[model samples]
Target: MRWGTFTSSNSVLLLIDHQVGTMKLIQNIPFETAKRNTLALTKAAKILGMPIILTTGTENGFQGPLLPEFKELVPEAYDARIARSGVVNTWEDPEFRAAVEKTQRSHLIMAGVTTDVCLYSPALSAVEDGYPVQAVLDASGSPTELSEQLARQRMERGGVTLTATNTLIAELARDWSRPEGSELLKLMVDDVLPPVF
Candidate 1:
């Protein structure tokens, strides 16, 4: 399958370990920018009617909960957000696996905090499991710029597609004529597009 062709029905959005603590530790991109991009991805996923699975390594301990802004974008009933205490790789967590299974999607759209750990682990695992996985680079973070770049290279080498959040939104939208296109445009305005002069 062409990596660019992603139908909402055939794709699932996986947000892993986007907890407050980890988000704050990201130095490669500004925390607010990462948050904005992540919010864009979540809002786009919701507007496109895609199944969403949100996971965190640990809530009460060091990781903290998912960003409040991110949580607010995802409706509780429409998406599944799981908190696992000890799993470094969300794919290794049974609940996360079950939620992915429930989506029944062949293509996985993913991004996460601390790219090397939270993002790389599951993305490569899913690819090994025969799922076409795409990682939204701008929406993910790492402790250092080098680490982030290396993680992306590792995933690309492992057959995972690397793309930006806007690209994913465009791919999912497919055309600007659709009603959802306007919604996606609004999201881009809030999170990505340059301000009007």
Candidate 2:
């Protein structure tokens, strides 16, 4: 697939199933690392004035509600979040699909809990629907390394571009001298990056 650069105006952030219980299932990476990267993506999107669509699957069940920090960070998205009752693939949910369509942006930057299920399914669906997707791997994980690896392979094969949080931020920022870029840099240093000893 020929890739186009992701700009703030051309991309939308899709955060799926970053709920309390679902988050606990992430074992391919440290829980804190995933959480931090997810938050960093949220903060970066806010800085760039990018559209953010937050979704959760069966929140009333084991999935649980989205993390509290999302509400505190991006209140508008949190308020308008898509709470799926039983939809495993977020793209299969009409409201979630509509929300993505409503954005009208062609590029989707997505991160979800349990990469094998939550992130994989919809990412492929989005690609099939003719949308270019960038799955933020560091912000999403699976319960095991094998699941994570398989999900990554499948998504890559399905034409979803895989990226990490820092790369996505830099791609969106474009220039460090700009105000938004500066703010994003601070977010990276303070939230995303691990400390250097």
lDDT of candidate 1? 0.85
- lDDT string for model 1 (73-179, tens) is 77672245787888888888998898889877888999989897789989999999988999998899899989998999999999999989888888888777879
Q: Evaluated with TM-score, which candidate comes out highest?
A: 2
TM-score of each: 0.94, 0.98
Minimum summed lDDT over a 10-residue window in model 1 is located at: 71-80
Superposed Cα deviation of residue 57, candidate 2 (Å)? 0.8
- The root-mean-square deviation over C-alpha atoms between each candidate and the true structure, in angstroms, is 1.7, 0.8
Candidate 1 vs. true structure, TM-score: 0.94
After TM-score superposition, what is the CA distance of residue 189 in candidate 1 from its true location, in Å? Answer: 2.4
Clash number for every model?
0, 0
Clashing pairs in 1: none
Query: lDDT score of model 2?
Result: 0.94
